[model samples]
Target: MLLFSPVLSLLALSVVGQQFTNPVLWEDLADTDVIRVNDTYYLTSSTMHYSPGAPILRSYDLVNWEYISHAVPRLDWGSKYDLTGGQRAYVEGIWASTFNYRKSSRTYYWLGCIRGSNTQIYTAPAAEGPWSRKGTISNCYYDAGLLVDPDTDIMYVAYGNTQLSVAQLSSDGLSQARTQNVFNSPSNIGTLEGSRFYKRNGNYYIFVTKPANGQYVLKASSPWGPYTSKQLLFNIQTPIAGGGIPHQGGLVETQNGVWYYMAFVDSYPGGRIPVLAPITWDSDGFPVIQTVNGGWGASYPYPLPKRVLESPVGTDTFNSTSLSHHWEWNHNPEISKFSVGAGLKLETVTVTNDLYVARNTVSRRILGPASTATIVLDYSGMKQGDRAGLALLRDQSAWIGIKNDSGTFRVIMVNGVAMNSNWSTRSTGSEVSATTVTGGKIWLRASADIRPGSGRQGRFSYSTDGKTFTTFGNALVMNNDWHFFMGYRFAVFNYATTSLGGEVIVEEFTLTAA
Candidate 1:
């Protein structure tokens, strides 16, 4: 059996031939929506405030997935999206999105919403995307769901917070023709959002997220619904994982007619991680999640898909002409601030007391239940008061970096602990530990042990020769909470708190299962 780390989520299971496990993706991939084109399955997830918004992943089998591309490389709506002038867009940017492939035109359509703007649609000839902005939907559609009717080919968007609304779109999916309220969840059912619409077996099915409860479905004979609703999955809790419910995801069927539901749990400090479950439909055609021995459980020994693939993230040599799909900027990265040709060159843009607001911090999703990340830093170009290193970045994060002070270079480990606030308003105080280095070239690493019994801690280390590593600072207690609304990531950052001339070249970066 190929078992994952039991400490990663609620529980872990092994893959045996056609049998696989739960939480199919152990990384931070939230607000997931899935679509099948031919034999290929494509998934798009929310990357709030992270540049390269709406990452699209591909899979031949439902069990294995790989990062393929991003729908939007950068959110250029405003300067705040770029972290310009001390402004930030944390827990904001492209939220939940709807992805579809139209057979009529051989075009791919993606629609998502950002604050201060209308719902935007991006189109491409293929999923890899040289995607162009088609246009925008007039009203704000939070957690929106888009559907291109298979018969009429008319596009429809279903979105709302407490009140659910469906709006008709033009054939091009650019303009809104008409809109109306579909269904409003009563006050007792928490907040209802994250709607994904579909047409199956000649019936219109709309799946919505009901927080604190699991996901529910609304079935209608027509697109504008006089709908009937039912709870699809009520028991989504896992005793071993301890994370909350698996809500806010979409459904997809395999080539051989096997059904599965993709959703996420609020695994804090880790971000919203994706979880998968085998689904079955009853005679009435409503989908149901398979349970273990008539109870809600995390991992189950279900038959896996026949195909398998390697993970999407791994080591990078900084040799690619463009940034890898595995990487995302903290915000819209300043193109001039970083280059990939001669190693990853990160030029300091501005001096900031907070690394959370620093621009051009390239990051990749951290693997779980445990993983180790390392980065080789060439600090020859580092200037005075410049700090460049590797970090586990989130609202409450830590780093091991080389800081150039005067003419002396030192290895410093600092922990950014935020006090009682979200990412944007969090008051962070940096605690510089007692460690020093006098070398111009150094390698930094962070190991995260997020398993249950380990107390979910991350520790940092540094090596001057890249052979012998020395531990630094105290263990950072990982905050597994929704306060940050995202997962922790392995990040490479360079910034000057004094001036903006300092820079660092990252020669290599690697992430390995620990």
Candidate 2:
């Protein structure tokens, strides 16, 4: 029988206690978009510059969410563009996407703007697998929104340029049928982006956010006509002033006829976290958002979904033929890098000339806030310049990794400068002899804390067994900017050298909120 120490027992008890305190689901997701299909719910959100553009999450209830798949595998649209060199060009590759379920055809359609260029559309038969890319719609617009009119069988794509325009989508739901400008202000009221169209009882309503102020909802009787500006739904001049810039969200009406507004808040140091509020209709039939004195947080006053299919969290023996959902590449992974039989073996390939280019790596967005992520792997086949580490990355300039050097693993921080911070020495608790530990597994557990003025600080620790953990001593803190361009992500990478073949066998990996 395997014996455990008292400290290990106490740590396990603390983990159990924390779970009871926060039973709600998806406490860490941000930039969220949600859609309900019958009793099941699906969500997608921006993964700016990350390998997977938008993440597809499924939920039985609005509260608890599980990551299912990604909408776009890579952001490689055209040339080898690098957003990592402080260029904010690819901001709209995955920002503010909408998931709409067309009841007529029983198909799921996802629409998103490609920043400065045209709006792109993708469709899937089921929410789970085999999505089709339909290509760009309008070449001149940004920040696009889509809605289907059940009464007319007409699909409308609404987007914000200098003004707002609505275009009819073809029967195939890809190309544009007709285009018309719906609303355009006289003066420069920032950018009239983040628009949503809704038809309620013979009236058409459009809700948009003014980049200058906050957000206001406008009404129109027809899809394209004169729109009347109404009172502001949310007012926050500055984001730090508790003004939530409700960029992109869904106005969902429950089956029981209850209305709710799901949106995201600009909680900077806290990241752009998600918030839910109950919406009520006024005497004039306009939706009113309730703002309490303190601030907005997760509110699931309604009962959560009871019928859920819970997948195994951490039980991959790596005997399959293909990569599991548990495994992700840095950008778009080459098929030759990985193989599975006795165990999951990952080989490091030569970086392409387009290494700094767009959409090179394959990665999944970090799902929950405080989660334990572990992978049992062997790293005896690494040479100088070859590395395998768990990375918390956001482009090439902004990333940190805990890497294995030859036989021993150490915590190393990497920014843009190739030699400035590469392979800096850091301390850790566990140490295995270079020769003794030939091909043993190493596990890392990380926790994220958004401290004031500190931005997002992530602390990582390592353990041989899943029991005893030793802190890595140093923490990585992200620098915050006013633009709100980037968010948080965690990944794994293996870089190969010339002489040594970079191979790692991953036995099992799991992530559950701390």
Best by lDDT: 1
Q: What is the Cα-based lDDT of residue 483 in candidate 1?
A: 55
The lDDT of model 1 is: 0.79
Cα lDDT tens digits, model 2, 180-262, are 99888656354556776677777777767665335666677888878876655444322233324544465666666666666
For residues 1-514, write the lDDT of model 1, one tens digit per residue. 1112222222234446444566677788888999888888899998888988888888766667877789987787789889998788887887788889888888998988776468888988999888778887768877888888888888888888868888898766678899999888876666788999888888888899887557889898988788788888665565237566777788887776888887887766677777777789889989888877664446655544345454444667778788778889989988988998668999998687678777888898888778998888999898888878888887777888887878788787888556346456355456567555665678899998654332588999888888999899877887776655678888899988888988889988877885
Candidates in order, TM-scores: namely: 0.92, 0.78
Q: What's the residue-level lDDT of 234 in candidate 2? A: 44
Note the residue pairs that clash in candidate 1. 8-369, 10-241, 18-304, 270-487, 271-486, 271-487, 411-437
